[model samples]
Target: MRRPQLLHLGGRPRQHAEREPRHRRFCRSSVALTVGLLLTGCAGGVEPGDAASPGPAALPEGVAVEIVQLRADVAVRQAQVHIVNGSDADLEIGDVAVDDPRFVAPATRVLPGRTSRVPAGGEVDIRVQLPDVACARDDVEPSEPTVALGFTVDGAAGTARVTADDPLGFLAPLHERECRAAALAEAATLAFTGFMPAPTGEPARLELTVTPTGGGSATLVAVQATNLLDFGPATVDGAFPLDVTVAPDDIAPIVVDIPILPSRCDPHAVQEDKRGTIFDVRLTLAGDPGEIELFVGDALRGDILTWVSSWCGFAGTP
Candidate 1:
């Protein structure tokens, strides 16, 4: 009963000439009047070719980066660098790293043997391994996400300090989920105590016992649905948050029943299952709402998988 939790630019431009090409330049600008006029942006706010390399630019208002986790990435300790390029030009991305206060260390992008890029007015997702949580830090400010981005804008190389935009707002939730899970863990322990199969495609009740470690209080909100398993009569989307109070100072463990149903009929789902049997528990620890994902353990996982085969009439398909 435990839980856990982008840009590219185009071609190289001429340099060190009396007339520099019209483009964004981080380096010295050309002295020629035509070149200077053509150069759209230069570093240091000085004349072209007169100043130091351009400092990282502020990401345009429409351009944005955010941290997101797809279903596959949820338990893999990975996420995507979601980039939305609403600007007028394409961005050729180079080195990318995320600066998130909630994480103990910064996260870097994982390239798959090719240059990562975002087209103008388009979107891209770059995979990155997630970092450890820095949630225990009481001294730091709340989650403020930013990216140290190396990119090419208008054929000119530049770096940017971009404020991440979260349309789905996954960052703060990630922080809250981890911190609350940690707090609840310190206060109590949650584990799948038992499973009673009803057989013949009926709802099987899974038991979870909450043992108070005698520290804090929490409410077991509900269990969310997984791709292959569902809690019925599950949500319109399936598996909803169950309501229960796991108060502190309890001498004995409290057992709660989770009614589960098989949501998928495909045998391949179980054959290649990753998180199908795993469960996410929504809870409020000491009034701070968050979610904790618990694994069914190897033994129980096999049992659940087998039970699924039969329930879905998939008994030997695996």
Candidate 2:
């Protein structure tokens, strides 16, 4: 993946203003901010009867199972499960069950064409809502044994068992959960979007938005800024770069307006050169554990528009 270059807002003067009350609706109070990430499926087919397969031999004769995404951290709260049909005939999954009391597989159902297919692959989302009883009462040591997965195929005599690999494989869901939690923690806070030259030709303006998770507060104190002009011909810097404060419950659009003049060098291409003068604003923030998530938007002459994203967690938690 290519990393987008962020502009530095340093050396460009800024004008600060208070956030309006009407624009304060994006920040919700105490709702779960689910950061959904689609896990990519592996290439080719999962080998039948492999350790990663979800079914045991000499039991139910039906669809085969494959574990795609496993993690040790469960903070992310959700996971994606994949299964590939390896039988000569169509196979059916009656239901999926987790024997472990601590693990909860919320979503378990065969997709339409993907299910009951020969040499076909399918997936289901496994949500982890570890009960307080398990999280609080369970003192299971790291070296202790774990449970297996029970799969009841359609019209099967008995349930098949998929013994989970102790430690690493069994706790795979937890790891993904933690990563998502870290992302939510980072995302539900303040992040700097960077500075851009305002149309009014004043000090360069810095634009950023703050998103909040239901827990804790964060403050953005701008300590340093760096300016770069390698991408385009224009350059802008902050005159007096200082700390900027962002309240936790405040999910508002903060714009620091500044004054900047375009520098043109060519004679015949002066207007085009002036338009190309682009300076990237890069800012350093002093705040809680989180990252700066980047969102890029493109417009094609007002006819078509699109947006892309790459997250940069602030405070290093993401």
Candidate 3:
């Protein structure tokens, strides 16, 4: 017998080749599993409840915000926030969040999904709603409450602070009324000195010193005088020139001369102190065209009329 036809099949053994295939398959499976895990991670494997990461750095330039109007009724309180885009590029407002505990809004209306487009050099108004209780508290003084606004300008996130002017008037009716009254009171202070005869024989003159009392200046526009009895014009309707400017806490002297005509006077009644003469003077201020009732005291009125009567040669009973 060919003692042993025990010849090797090839240079390598079959057992080693079979084991090599198994090893390669195991390695491929392991690599696929690892790559699958990594891809899943990249494609939002994070939980839904996870907090959002911080946004990109820097905010778009030339964006401004201001509180234009605030209104409050029994049901809701709302503020109109005016946003101005001063830059040349259009702005996409992603969302606006007022970091005030008093404010509240529906999540659907706040941000991310709700967006506003503002063209360059244009402006937009956004409404911010708050609880009515927030406006219920009284504000004793003029307070400019600063509010923080968190919003995105052209996809860039930023925070800004705005100073609101007199937003507390919604609290109480008396609050606004008192504020207006105080402002009107502080607008000016008037003093009536004695009257004197004018150099012009037909008219009598009086001196008035007007002083501005508040933090602002006042421009005296015009003054009108009317008789209390018949509402007749006591002085020429447009005779006095009142283009006077009074600085804050400064005084300006004005002289008013009126024609002392006896056509509307009752000499007998004037003789009797019972039917005294009264005149109502109205002072008009520039910018605020509303007439401010100027005080002409009873004594001052009597003095003015007495001088007029003497100048007109009617100083006797009818």
lDDT of each: 0.64, 0.29, 0.41
- The TM-score values for the models, in the order shown, are 0.59, 0.32, 0.33
Model 1 accuracy (lDDT, Cα): 0.64
Top candidate by TM-score: 1
Cand. 3 TM to true fold: 0.33
Ranking by lDDT: 1, 3, 2
Candidate 2 lDDT at 74 equals 24
lDDT of 1 by residue, 147-205 (tens): 66667667766666555544445677777767776778777888887888877657998
Pick the winner on lDDT between candidates 1 and 2.
1
- Order of candidate numbers by TM-score, starting with the best: 1, 3, 2
Between the candidate structures 2 and 3, which one is better when assessed by TM-score? 3
RMSD of each: 10.9, 18.6, 33.6
